[model samples]
Target: MIQQGISPRPEAQIFDADTHLGSNTFSIGPSRTSDGSTFLAVNSHQPWEGAVTWYEAHFHSEQGLDMTGGLFPGSPMILVGHNRNLRWSFTVNHPDLVDTYVLEINPDNPNQYLFNGEWLDLEVRQAPIKVKLLGNLSWTVKQEVLWSVYGPVVRQDHGTYAIRYAGMGLVDIWEQVYRLNKATNFKEWQSAMRQGGFASFNVGYADREGNIYYLYNADLPIRTEGYDWSLYLPGDTSETLWTQYLPFDDLPQVLNPAAGFTQNSNSSPFQTTLDPDNPHPDDYSPTLGIETQMSNRALRALELLGSDESITFEEFILYKYDMTYWADSDVPRMVQMILDAPTPQDADLLDGIEILRDWDYDADPESIGATIAILTLYDLARTSKSFLGSRLVGGEFTSEEVLDSYQRTVESMLEHFGRVDVPWGDINRLIRGNVDLGLGGGPDLLHAVGG
Candidate 1:
């Protein structure tokens, strides 16, 4: 490791990768919308999974439904869109649901465990796992799947653990979606949400009745007050067991926010609207584990949307496609770190630094320095502050790393494209069939380029 550091071996570094779903959704009521009707907009990006398609459903003796979104074949959308008086969409809310408990097994029988001062037998079952060796030739092998009062148990070489996750035995999740589709008003919608099988998602809603809402909806277990839920709990007692869920009314929500708009970019629910209307983080329990980071998309959305009181439909769409990463956002901060650093004496490094400094924050096609700036983040994915894990959710990188990444980006661009001053449009493109268009947005922007 020491010898390799003598030369520029960026490849010697190992990246710690983490990824989570990111999406943007917002709603506007009649007072703020263009057509005198509520406006709901969603840009759910799942590039690997593809986008949602419009669909219509008509059932015998039931209300017809029109939807402009698709779902995974087996999954249901309690986040119904344009089905009734209201339209709704979802952004993933990564609430705490899963918990692990360290098991203390009985010495005489591994199948027995101690719970609340008494030893009890674990409920063990063997399920058949079918494996295929060749085409149409399969074998069934029985694997032990154990269960306990805690929920489920896993035995590994290091230790025994029991896990408890919310909605473990859920079967009527589809029913909730179906009910949500048929709900014509706010009351009906709330009743449907009371069923509460949704594992993760923050719902954004707007209705023809001039109502708008944002909900940080989840089926989260009500954990006990004392223990550190981040670590494994002691399984010997029932103290770690969390049975109840926060009531539907307790989930973070805002209805008809004073700001005239509500939005979530998979960020904190506390900042869903203007400062006056945004939820107070201290009001909710830390045990719920609500997200508190502001995304670049969220910051941009607030700057654009909240700036105007009488925003036109054209402006609404314009705000949705806003591509500039906010000044305080990770991208700009990281880039500034590189720019403010002492310019290296090398010719190419000086050229790279100048490109970054001359660049405007926008990712438009004609932006001269945009190519090198964006590619720097792209080339050094995990190592780049604004490109790591969830950039919008606040990532970090050192000044040294940022400068190194910029150097690599300049080197790569010269070797391949043969120039550092190439347009961002030339490098980052949206290609379909034989046609190509310049992608005007960077990652996590409201107008996502790839997704």
Candidate 2:
């Protein structure tokens, strides 16, 4: 079926256009740190300027509320940050909390739909959308909105569809975040989380009490069995309607694991920590639609944080700024694919391949290799039909595509800089008013910077 307002495209080709929008948050417990002090890093990768851009702020009140962290424009409460006693941060989580159903509309009565062997009238209402025509001039249009037993109804060209999503009418998110900001300990924080107002996020929390926690927090709908929730479901049955959510206790979480650390880089909750501590896929129902993909940031986090036995605060800070891709990650694999392909006769293409071959997989500002590899990968991510996101999992690029991307990178570099060995910093720059600086870290790295 055609998605409303979106043009027809390959399902796999659908991706988040805001590639820079991701986050990395980790909590280190006392047992894993050198000084026996708990540490938490609250890092969110957001656009530098937008309505959702982060602004640092501290909120204080007489009713035992004190928080300092980042929040969106006009947001009264902090979305991710720390208080005096504890700290917590959020990273995006992928859970199937929404489902679309193909509704069987009655041709005899257009507003009536077939459900449970009975004809049900759709709830129709008028929604007013105000459009600004010019300065201080606005036009208000009343649009017809429909609702079904599932949720909102969308009339598509192919058929009528109803979408059901978690937290449909819940509007207490500010209250929950306020409770979280006022929480002074783990129990209080978890109690705040039990409000179940947040729809989806991977929460990384640490407190002065040496307690660390990682929660794959979501208001997940309890769906029926034997139906593929990923695809459109039959709307003509009550079985497809999910009216309840899983209890907050059933959500995947890790509390002060023996591993002493927990992280989420928009990856699978099953890989939040070491195997014994991480959530098991078998425990959750498949209808929940929890993702299983691991991002390169997640893999590198596991490598760096898992290997270090006792991490100092300095080391923790250093690890947070790491820019190297993992050895087994897709970047090196793609580089190898280019090398193993039939050698191109063009000298510029050959030079690009040699630069990639001799280069280390680090997105350092001064590194010439990163310039070639990252530019080519960015091009591939834009042009390749199979590419999805920074994770680069389940996507395939043929040798021809890889070579063509590399050749394009070489040509662009030659055209602009007169050489293929330009430093990454020269191109990937950070500019402000009268302040221009070179920045390190390419996309998907620990210190990710999207140029």
Whole-model alpha-carbon lDDT for candidate 1 = 0.75
Model 2 worst lDDT run, 10 consecutive residues: 6-15
lDDT of 2 by residue, 272-316 (tens): 888799999999998887888887888899999999989999999
Clashes of each: 0, 0
Residue clash pairs of candidate 2:
none
lDDT of 1 by residue, 1-451 (tens): 1222221232332212233346789887766666665677876766643344423333323345444445653444424456647778888776777777778889899999989998899998999999998999999999999999998898987668788888888888788887777778888887887887577689998877889999988887787787656556778777688888888787889999877899988788998988788889898887777767777888888887787777788888888888787878766776788879986887877877787787768888787676777777665575654456464546766778877888888888789977778887877787778988876777767776643
The model with the greatest TM-score is 2
User: lDDT (CA) for every model shown?
Assistant: 0.75, 0.86
| Model 1 spans with C-alpha error above 4 angstroms | 1-21, 48-63, 74-80, 384-387
- Which candidate comes out best when scored by lDDT? 2
Model 2: lDDT of residue 423: 94
Query: Residue 37: error of model 1 in Å?
Result: 3.9
